[model samples]
Target: MLVITVDLVPSGYEPMRRTIATMSISNISELAEVSDYQIEATETSNPLAGTPPRTVRCLIREHARAQSVWALVARASDEIMKADSAEL
Candidate 1:
C-alpha cells in the first residue's frame, strides 16, 4: 500500500490544506496498466481565514508509464482548482 499526501491551495485563498490518500498498489511493477484514481476531499476548518473551506473531488487517469506519484497528484490538484472542475 502507498500513502500519499497532497497539499492544496484553493482558488482565491492564502492558507493551504492537505489531502491524504492510500492506494492499493505499491511499487512501479504493480502498475503495469492504466489505472483510474479518485481523490475525495472534505471541507477543512480554517479558523484564521474568513472564507469558507473548500471541498474537492479529483479524478485522475494515471498511465502505466507514469514516473512519479507526485506528478499524478499535482495534476489532480490543478484539476481541483479549475473553474469548471471538481471543487465544491
Candidate 2:
C-alpha cells in the first residue's frame, strides 16, 4: 500500500517531525489532519518566512492531502523566500 508522509526539510525541530501523522494514500482523511500538521510543520520544521502564520496562510489556503499539499507549500515557501531576498 502506498503511504503519504510529510517530507519537509528538517530544522532540528524533532517534535514537529515526530508529530507528523503518516497517512495512507488510500485514506480519504489525509486532508483532515493536514491543517494543523502542516502549520506546525511549516512553522517549526521549515520556517521559510518571517511570520509563520502569515506564511502558512499564503501557502495553504485550501484543503488538500498532506503529501501533495506539503510539496506545494514547500515550493511556495521557496518562491516567497526568493522574492523576499531579492527585495534586499
Candidates in order, TM-scores: namely 0.46, 0.22
lDDT of 2 by residue, 1-88 (tens): 2344544435976655553223332223344654322221222232454443222222234434446745654654554444322111
**Overall lDDT per candidate, in order of appearance:** 0.50, 0.38
What range of 10 consecutive residues in model 1 has the weakest lDDT sum?
Answer: 20-29
Q: Output the lDDT of residue 76, model 2.
A: 46
RMSD of each: 7.7, 10.6
The prediction achieving the highest TM-score against the true structure is 1
Query: Candidate 1: which pairs clash?
Result: none
> Tens digit of lDDT per residue, candidate 1, span 6-67?
45657836465454322222333345567665555444444666435565655666545445
